[model samples]
Target: MSQHIQRSIDSPLRTGLNREQLWEDHDKGLIKCWEVGRQRAARFPELANQCLAGELPVLGWKGGVSRSLKKLEKFGSLKYLAQWQGLRGEDLNIDLSEERELTCSRTAMVVTFTPDRSKYFNQVAEA
Candidate 1:
């Protein structure tokens, strides 16, 4: 029998994965998933961390990861600014216009915003 089948047949107590062990395993799995996400973000250094985090809300992208990144950039959450030093402007400017056009082609609405002094004053008063 396969190890998976053997594990399935074994009781939790016999297998040594008690409640605490099960919880630890669950936490480890979560950490592994988070590490994978971080690795992906590292591979695409041009994209913002917010873009990667937003993937969960949009249900894992379904082969639309590039589209999601463009949407984040369009909405101003992801800017052209570099997050770290040692990155050249020329290197980072890799066909962004084409990517943006392709990704945002199907977008229904694209909203851009700028904050005014009035909004800041209101926020200060509320705080």
Candidate 2:
């Protein structure tokens, strides 16, 4: 049973990334935060550290690692289809249309569940 802890959404770290540019680049599938970090590290690890420490700007965005990751998760190519806190917690159904369904729990237990995307998608298509 591993616990998925929620990380801080903000920090002193900053990237010189413009908000619009960041979103635009993400929308264009140019690159993701992880990729950006990898590129920065490859190019200049020291500068990357400075960017992470808020001593320098990166991609024109002023945000911490967690914030960057969140933004990437939201707009990046990756898809987080579902997230469940527990058996009692509400089920968050994320569909292609971004419509979320909040369904009450019928049992008690902190169990997070996520369906296999490929299988689920195949089933849906077949139906």
Worst 10 residues of 1 by lDDT: 2-11
lDDT of 2: 0.27
Residue lDDT tens for model 1, 1-127: 1111011111122244455654345232222223333444557554434343322111131112233333343321112111110111111221212222212233332322111223223321100
For residues 21-109, could you state the per-residue lDDT of candidate 2 as single tens digits? 65455232122333344444556656545433433122322111222221121111112211111111212222232322222122111
Query: For model 1, what is the error of residue 22's alpha carbon versus the real structure, in angstroms, after optimal superposition?
Result: 12
Could you estimate the TM-score for every candidate?
Answer: 0.23, 0.22
> What is the total number of backbone clashes in candidate 1?
0
Q: Please count the clashing residue pairs in each candidate, in the order shown.
A: 0, 11
RMSD to native for every prediction? 18.2, 17.4
